[model samples]
Target: MSMVVTSPDFRWGLKFFKYLEIAKVNYFTNTTYLANFLSKSIMVVLRIWIFTQLYRVTYATANENEIGGLTVPMVIWGLMIAQSLNTATRPQLSKLIDEEVKSGVIAYSINRPYSYILFHYFGSMGRFVSNLISNLTLGFLAAFILVGPISLSWNGLLLGSLLLFFGYTLDFLIDLMIGLISFWVEDISAFNWIYSKSQLIFGGLILPLSLFPDYLRNIAELLPFSQLFYSGSRLIVNFDFQLFQKYLLIQMAWLVFFWLLVGYVFSKGIKHVSVNGG
Candidate 1:
């Protein structure tokens, strides 16, 4: 006699597939908004153009081919790359959480069969992918038209791409933490503002660390912010093996810290949540 065996109809991986489905739905949904797409695309071109002229004037005044070891083309390309990824992880995640928390709708999601944080992350990722693709295309087109191409290396490109993934993960984790804090605090606007500005000033959003003095650059070496916006752009402008290695180490350390922090915050946040049946 033989026993017949059959697999379970449901699998753990199905939950992950749901997450992917969330991302996919968001990506396609965001792409359908032609007005938003046009506005973003136009802004990418406009910003790059304005910067290109600024770089030309600054270089003309200084009478240098490169400043702080950075060329006109280098900075332009860096801005294009930085700006492209800039829109990837928006503070919209925090706003969504804050709104849900304020509305008491988060209570409903608590009993859902999926991870709440992962649900939000995957949902945001859908929009992130849509924005990234459109921004990159416009950024590169504008950069190329105005400044010409900058030389790139295999290692630089590869490492820069990895850094972007690391950056996005860390960014999402920070947003998650802030959003979860809403369970305790009524407002997260201040937190959001500080995070945004920190990323702008220190994360190399508009200004790459390469534009700074050697001492400042050295200081940035110890900062994780530089790893987010600066490292990618730095490698784009000029790739140094030693610098790339150092950035990898810093980024990994920050990623680990934030990963643990978010877990703790989420657990605490859930306890504070008050629920009402809808």
Candidate 2:
């Protein structure tokens, strides 16, 4: 008798393809096309407009390089990159997980072939790809119209893309933990709000950390939140290879930490639900 054989990597590739297919289906079936497009367009336009004015006015009399370690174009590009990642990597896992828990549909997910968290991750990537392409197109067009272009070499672009993947994964893991917390909390909105604000304030959303006061900037540098926004955005704008390695390392560390935390909570949550006959 002859038997078929496949490599482990090949099997995993097949699994990823399966989840990606499901994600594509969800993206098309679940998305409200016109509403999503119009809303995203408005958001990108408004953000690009506001930041263009803000940076131009703020840097009017200042030396761009010395003031915030950023020029006007650099600031705009940083914002563009950050916002792209924001829209692209906005994990829908928490909301979906919450709905499934409430509907008692999570039990069905337990029988699924893939890891639940990874399934959600891959599914989010499907939607994210759509959002990323559209958002970047709209955002970069608006940015060019408003501020002209920001130069990034091909090597910078490649490194920045690599850093962005790590940053996005770190963000996804964080979102995963928050989603898993739904097992204990009735609503995770407050937690999400806090996390978003932390990113806004400390993750270099409003301004680069270089522009912040020493104390505040120091704190942000030490936080995982900075890796989500600041590190990736800075890599895009600055593209320092040494800093790239450092931030990539930090993001990897945080990803591991959060992954372990999510696993622990998941195991414990499952036990609790089983005991309660959920």
> What are the lDDT figures for the candidates, one per model?
0.80, 0.77
Highest TM-score: which candidate?
Answer: 1
Q: How much lDDT does candidate 1 score?
A: 0.80
Task: Give lDDT tens digits, candidate 2, residues 1-278.
Answer: 12223777777778878888878975774456768544665676688689889889888756354465678888887888787767666545677778877777787786667788778877777777777777788888888888898778776788878877777778888888887788889999998889888888878777878788888877777789989867877877777888878777777888889889988998887654432253
The candidate that wins on lDDT is 1
TM-score, cand. 1? 0.91
- Which lDDT tens digits does candidate 1 get at residues 1-278? 12222333345467778999989998898878699765766776788888899889988998899887789899888888887777755536889899999998888887888888888889989988888888888888889889888889988888888877787877888888888888888888999898788777778777767677778878866776666666877785688888788888898998899889998888888888876666
Each prediction's RMSD over C-alphas, in Å, is 2.8, 2.5
Model 2 earns a TM-score of 0.90
Model 2 spans > 4 angstroms off = 5-10, 30-32, 61-66, 274-278
